[model samples]
Target chain A: MAITFPVEASHILMFARAVGDPNPVYNPASAPGGVIAPPTFGQAVAQFDPEYHLRPKPGQPWFGSGKTPSGVDKAPSAGGLHAEQHFEYLRPLRPGDVLTVEIKPGATWEKESKRAGKLTFRERIAEYRDQTGELVLIARGVGVTTERPVDQG
Target chain B: MALSASRIKPGDTHSETVVSNLTRTQIVQYAGASGDYNPIHTDEVYTTKAAGYPSVFAHGMLTMGLTGKMLTNYVGDGRLLKFGVRFTNQVWPGDTLVATATVTEVADLVVKLDVVTTNQDGKDVVRGSAEARIDP
Candidate 1:
């Protein structure tokens, strides 16, 4: 099952500022078309409650990952590593435009850990769309979950 | 002088100054501030033998943050359009990163930059590209 999240322009602006991106395009009052959001603004979308828009319907336990940050794993292994990420922008996100994000799992696999434990790699693709169903952005991310014996020191 | 798209030829180079007497505390602060708590980045033991890394390293994004800072500061605001990076190498504690950019392509309103971060040893720590739209 797929999950969707709703985002506010303020959150994106905050994120862009946090990353030190001071581009005026992210400024609502200064942007050219009265200023849209940043090109990378789609990053704020999450598959879980911290950003989830609507709860999954009953019997959709697969979509609920029990508070995992990305909502892709119910119990993420210890020592998660950010592997890679890619983003594509289709249209500018404007202020007052609410984004509906749809997340789809891309792939999941296991490998011998590079850090002396087992590792699980998971990738997901998220699509951000505006109220009128205009595609705004597409984000693909890969995460690494590390597992080591609890008693191994 | 501002480096406008029209002024940059295909091999033009851009450089920005950076200083770092990086402390362990700064590393931890970046981890907390960014919510990226990978143990190898915060814990020394895990980074060395456990993670097979030479030593505790700074967050890739933290270094990217420095690049972002320079880009905005250079463009003098209201001109940058998009920026992103792919992490290539680890930046260890106490290493000062110098970020540089080279013009790859130029359009009427856009300039593409091949940006890179290098340590004092001249080793590239991170490499990426950025696009800035010159405001008329």
Candidate 2:
């Protein structure tokens, strides 16, 4: 699926406050311009609306059956864990700067396990770029979809 | 609190830090603030019976927040560049966890550290690595 989302400054401030990140860049009082979003604020970019945010739709491949309106949940396994996360910051996020988050399946590895019995593990990689088309940050996240019992030996 | 990188030694050990007890309120707050609403963290029965856990547990990221406190309190603010951790063991309520970090590698611009947190029973609850950038 191809879509674009315009990230607003308010969304960044709300997320930073919620996570207890006291960085001045993220605080309105500290930033005369606007709040500076936290490093993890890139994760919120995945929820942007296509029509309202993107330039155009270039029909892309649809992989999963279920999809969250935020476009983050595309797997049938309603369950997901932040198994691992890594971020590289290129520049700080400023207020009133809209962003585009291009998401795609990074890697899909299926394994045969006595416990998991044989399920697919998917890693969704999302990259965020500011309105100026400069890379802001990259977020790589892994989600596990298993049909086996939570307790299987 | 400011952490002095110069005072840290390869073998220097920190006094054990006890979390005292984990509370449901803490988990709920973490869920709301962190945007992680995984049911296992909030649903006790589901976690206990379905997830094969002893009880409802804390978010790995929430525990990471505690670990971040351990680092920023040691290495000073605005110095950490890249910090990462893997969830090896699960932490539960009433389990007091201790965090410790040791300098593994040092340089003019970067220093590497190995960090860990364990329960009173000596069971390792979390293990990870952190890095900080030092002034030249």
Give the candidate number with the greatest TM-score: 2
Could you tell me the interface RMSD of model 1? 7.9
As a whole number from 0 to 100, the lDDT of residue B34 in candidate 2 is 51
lDDT of 1 at A34: 58
- TM-scores across all candidates? 0.60, 0.65
Please provide, for model 2 over A1-153, each residue's C-alpha lDDT reduced to its tens digit, 9 standing for 90 to 100. Answer: 433555556665566554444556556667655555554555554345334221123464222212322222332232444455555556556666666777778888876756545657788776777778888766666656556533422
Question: Candidate 2: TM-score?
Answer: 0.65
- Stretches of candidate 1 off by over 4 Å are A1-80, A90-97, A107-123, A142-153, B1-3, B23-34, B42-56, B74-84
| Candidate 2 wrongly placed segments (more than 4 Å) | A1-78, A91-99, A111-119, A147-153, B1-18, B45-54
Candidate 1 lDDT, B1-136, residue by residue in tens: 2456555677888686554666677777655445455555666654554444556677666676667666655554445555667665666778777888887878887777787878888887667777776643
| Every candidate's TM-score, chain A alone | 0.65, 0.65
Each candidate's DockQ: 0.15, 0.17
